[model samples]
Target: MSNRVVQGRMVTPGTLAELIEGSPVLETEDITDADRPCPECDGDVIEVGYMPSVTEFVTGYKCQDCDWSDDDRE
Candidate 1:
């Protein structure tokens, strides 16, 4: 009689060895602040996005009462 291993019915010790090695590590850093008030309507300024190439972060402010935005300045 010959011994044969079934695909789904077999699991070796190395099958889950990578899981016990270590957990993944992640690093995060705060880049900018968007807590400044809007100059036009005294609204809150929020962070829209960032431009890593130019090293510039874009911020936009929206007013609920006056409907003002920083886009109007550009």
Candidate 2:
């Protein structure tokens, strides 16, 4: 994996060391992680999981004081 960080936040370190990586972090409706900031809204990037059959990955990311929608990775 690249040592690159998205926007500024780093990906989980040493997370890919294992042979069988965990399931892809599926994004649900929309959530924000208070610890991580959102790249689009600059808000928190909450870790929420979605169903395995979801068409796309969705994560909740509310701007501190803006109307930006969540981030969807299709």
Candidate 3:
């Protein structure tokens, strides 16, 4: 099966298992470090944890001085 994104919408052409199994896996080193300032308060943003998932594929980051999170960005 094949998947394509047309005009910002993804056209699903396969099963859910196919999509999950075919998805790319990333390591901690492969992800960008959270060192930028937070958008809310100019606080130091740091890597707090990772996204909880069946595969646990992505990193989760937050600010040191504020409650800002990078979860939605992923």
TM-score of each: 0.28, 0.27, 0.44
lDDT for each residue of candidate 3 in 1-74, tens digit (9 for 90 to 100) = 23333223443322211222344333322123365788998866544223234576444544546546554333
- Model 3 CA lDDT for position 56: 65
What are the candidates' C-alpha RMSDs? 22.5, 10.7, 13.3
lDDT of 2 by residue, 1-74 (tens): 32223344444322211101244443333222446665666653334334334474333333343334343455
Deviating ranges (above 4 Å) for candidate 3 = 1-33, 49-51, 72-74
Q: CA lDDT, every prediction?
A: 0.31, 0.36, 0.42
**Best of the two (1, 3) by TM-score:** 3
What local lDDT score does residue 41 receive in model 2, on the 0 to 100 scale?
60
By lDDT rank, best first, the candidates go 3, 2, 1
CA lDDT of 17 in candidate 3? 17
- lDDT, model 1, position 27: 23
